[model samples]
Target: MARITYIEHNGTEHVVDVRPGLTVMEGARDNNIPGIDADCGGACACSTCHVYVDPAWVDRLPKKQAVEEDMLDFAYQPDPKRSRLTCQIKVTDAIDGLVVHIPEKQI
Candidate 1:
C-alpha cells in the first residue's frame, strides 16, 4: 500500500494507506475523504473527481490519456498544468507518498 495525502480546499488533510491497482479517486472514496465526488465512479467519464496534483508529485504520476484530458475540460476551475481526473491516476508503489489537493467544489 502507498501513503497518500488528500488536502481539501479548506486545508483539511486526510492521510490514507491505499492499495495498488486502484485509482486515486478510489483511494479517496474508499477512505471516506470528503472532496472527491466521483460521480461516475472510476470510469474516467466525469470531471467530479477532478483534483490538483501537488507540484512535487505531478511529474511522478502517469500522463493523462486522451479520454481523461477530454473530461478535464469539464472540470471546475481546470488548470491545464495541474488539474487531473483522480479516476485516471492509478495508485502504485512508485507514487508512495502522493499528495493531491481537492478543489473548492466539484460542480
Candidate 2:
C-alpha cells in the first residue's frame, strides 16, 4: 500500500492507504475523501477530480496526455504548474508518498 495525503482547500487533510495500481481518483473515492467527485470515473472527460500536486512531486508523475492537457482548460482551479486531474495520476512505488491538495469547488 502507498500512503497518500489529500488536503482540502480549508486545510483539513485525509491520509489514505492506497493500492499501488489504483488511480489517485480511485484511492480518494474509495477512501471517501470529500473533494474529489471524479464524476467521469477516470475517463479523463471531466475536471471534477482536479487536484494540485505538491510542487516537489510534479516532476515525478508521468507526463500528461494531450487530452488531459486540454481538459485542464476547463478546470476552474487550473494552475499550470500544479493542477492535474487526479484520475490521470496512478499510485505506484515510484511515488510512494504523494500529497495532493483539493480545491474548494468542483463542477
Candidate 3:
C-alpha cells in the first residue's frame, strides 16, 4: 500500500494507505475523504474527481493523456498546471507519499 495525503480546499487533510493497482479516486472514496465524487467511477468519463496535484509531486506522476485533458475541460475552475482527475492516477509503490489537493467543488 502507498501512503497518500488528500488536502481539502478548506484545509482539511486525510492521509490514507492506498493499495497498488487502485486509482487515487478509489483511495479517496474508500477512505471517505470528502470532495471526490467520482461520479463516473474511474471511467475517465467525467470530471467530478478533479484534484490538484501537489506541485512537489506533479513531475513524478505520469503525463496526462488526451482523454484526461479533454475531460478536465468540464471541471470547475480547472488549472492546466495542476488540475487532474484522480481516476486517471493509479496508485503505486513509487508514489508512496503522494499528496493531492482537493478543489473547492466538483460537478
Candidate 4:
C-alpha cells in the first residue's frame, strides 16, 4: 500500500495507506477525508477531486493527460503547476509519500 496524505484547506491532514492500482480519490473516499468530493467517482469526468500537489512531489508524479488537464480548468483556484484531479492519479509505491492539499471548495 502507498501512504498518501491529504491536507484540507483548513489545515486538517489525513494520512492513509492506499492499495496500489486505486486512484488517489479512492483513498480519500475510503478514509472519509472531507476535501475531495469525487462527484464523478474515478471517471475523470469532473473536477470535484481537485487538489494542489505538494511542490516537492509534483515532479515525482506521473504526468497529467489531456483529459485531466481539461477537467482541472473547472476546479476552484487551480494552480497551473500544482493542481491535479485525484481521480487521475493512480496510487503506487513510487508515490507512497505523496501529499496533496485540497482546495477551499469544489466547483
**Per-residue accuracy of model 4 over 1-107 as CA lDDT, tens digit each:** 99999999999999999999999999999999997999998898989999999999999998999999999888999899999999999999999999999999999
- Model 1 C-alpha RMSD vs. true structure (Å) is 0.6
Error of 3 at 64 (Å): 0.4
Instruction: Give the poorly placed runs of model 1, Cα more than 4 Å off.
Output: none
Candidate 1 backbone collisions, by pair = none
67: Cα error in model 4, Å:
0.5
The number of the candidate with the highest lDDT is: 3
Alpha carbon lDDT of residue 77, candidate 2?
Answer: 66
Candidate 2 C-alpha error for residue 23, in Å: 0.3
What tens-digit string does per-residue lDDT give for candidate 1 at 1-107? 99999999999999999999998999999999998999998887889999999999878788889998999999999999899999988889999999999999997
Candidate lDDT values, in order: 0.92, 0.92, 0.95, 0.94
Candidate 1 Cα lDDT to native:
0.92
Candidate 4: worst-modelled 10 consecutive residues by lDDT: 35-44
What is candidate 1's CA lDDT for residue 101?
95
Q: Report the candidate with higher lDDT, 2 versus 4.
A: 4
Question: What TM-score goes with each of the models?
Answer: 0.97, 0.96, 0.98, 0.98
